[model samples]
Target: MAGKLDRFEKLINSLSTWLNWVAGVGLVTMLALIVADIIGAKLFKWPIPGGIEMVGFLGVVVATFAIAQTQFLHGHIEVEFVVTKLPKTAQKVISCLTYSLGMALFALLSWQSFEFGRTLQTSGEVSMTQEIPFYPLAYSMGFCCIVVFLVLLVQCIMTMIRAKK
Candidate 1:
């Protein structure tokens, strides 16, 4: 059981690393697009259509997809004042509980986001500027949320296991 769990952790870590890289690429692309748009508007006097909307979408993708990596790196915000003073066992328990709640919240958000995306897709919703379909991007956000939730769940379980030991 321990070996299996260890293997699962490794798999999740690998997947998170790949996702982090993808998110980094997305961030860079978004930055480049924004800079180009700015330069075009300021210097060339020609702004790209729907540039803001595109950047917004890319930003969401970058942020959401990077969540797992952030958690894996312990980069998420932590109010550690009390936690840091607690006993090791208590700290582990609190960490497990915190992550469990986070998992639940993200799961709920993913479900609602998916439903919203489906409704938009069914209604053929499009962005105001370029008439770009918004549903696919929304659904992708939901998918990223799901990935983050799964990563949190794995972390929660791992913490529980460690607490036992």
Candidate 2:
């Protein structure tokens, strides 16, 4: 079981790491786009059309895609000062509870995002300036949220296993 869990964890971590790379790319792209936009607007007097909309979309990609990797690395903050004072068992319980809540929250976000993406696709919703389809971004958010949910689930399971020992 431990071996299986370790393998699964590795797989998820690898996927998360890949997603993190994508987030970094998105961040860099956003930076370049904004810089170009600023330069064009100020110097050339020809700003990139839909630059703002593109930046907003890339921001979402950067934020969402990095979440799983962050969670996997225990990079997210927790009020550990209070939790550390508790008994070991209580700490484990609290950890499990929090992870469960995170799983639930991310799962719901994934579901709702998918539903919204479908709606957007069906309605042909798009950005005003770029006319870029909204559904792809919504779908990306949904996928990223699922990755977060998976991370939480793995942590929750590990916590439970530790509690049993």
Candidate 3:
């Protein structure tokens, strides 16, 4: 079971790494677009059309898509002073609980985001400036949420197993 869990962890880490790379690309693209828009607006007295909208979309991509990788890396902030003082088993229990809570929250977020995306799709909702469809980005958010939720669920399971041992 440990071996299986480790292999699953490796697979999830690989997928999260790929998502992080894609998020990096999105960030770079957003930066380039913003720079170009600034230059065009200031120097050429003509702003790049839909530049803001494009950057906004890319920002969502960069932020949402990196969440799974960030969780995998344990990059999020933690207040460990109290947890560290607890016995090892207690700490593991607390960790499991925390991860369970996180999984639940993200799962809810994923479901709600998917529903919102569907609503947007049905309504033909779009950005005012670029007329860019909103559903795709919402769907991306939902996907990312699922990825994070899966990561947390795995962590919760691992913690429970460790606590038992």
Q: How close is every model to the real structure, measured as TM-score?
A: 0.91, 0.97, 0.96
Q: By TM-score, who's the top model here?
A: 2
Per-residue CA lDDT of candidate 2, range 11-107, in tens?
8999999999999999999999999999999999999999999999999999999999999999998889999999999999999999999999999
Per-residue error for 37 in candidate 3, Å, reads 0.4
Report the C-alpha displacement of residue 73, candidate 2, in angstroms. 0.8
RMSD of each: 1.5, 0.8, 1.1
Off by over 4 Å in 1: none
Residue 84 lDDT (model 1): 91
Candidate 3 local lDDT, 31-113, one digit each (tens): 89999999999999999999988998999999999999999989999999999999998899889889988988999999999
lDDT order of candidates, top first:
2, 3, 1
Ten-residue region with minimum lDDT total, candidate 2: 75-84
What does candidate 1's lDDT look like per residue over 1-165, in tens digits? 879878877887788888889889999999899999999999999999999998988887788788888987779889999899989999998998899899899999899989999999999999899898989877877887777787887888888887887
Relative to the unseen true structure, what is the C-alpha lDDT of residue 127 in candidate 1, on a scale of 0 to 100? 84
Which pairs of residues collide in model 3?
none
Task: Pick the winner on TM-score between candidates 2 and 3.
Answer: 2
Cα RMSD for candidate 1? Answer: 1.5
RMSD of 2: 0.8
Where is model 3 poorest over a 10-residue stretch in terms of lDDT? 153-162
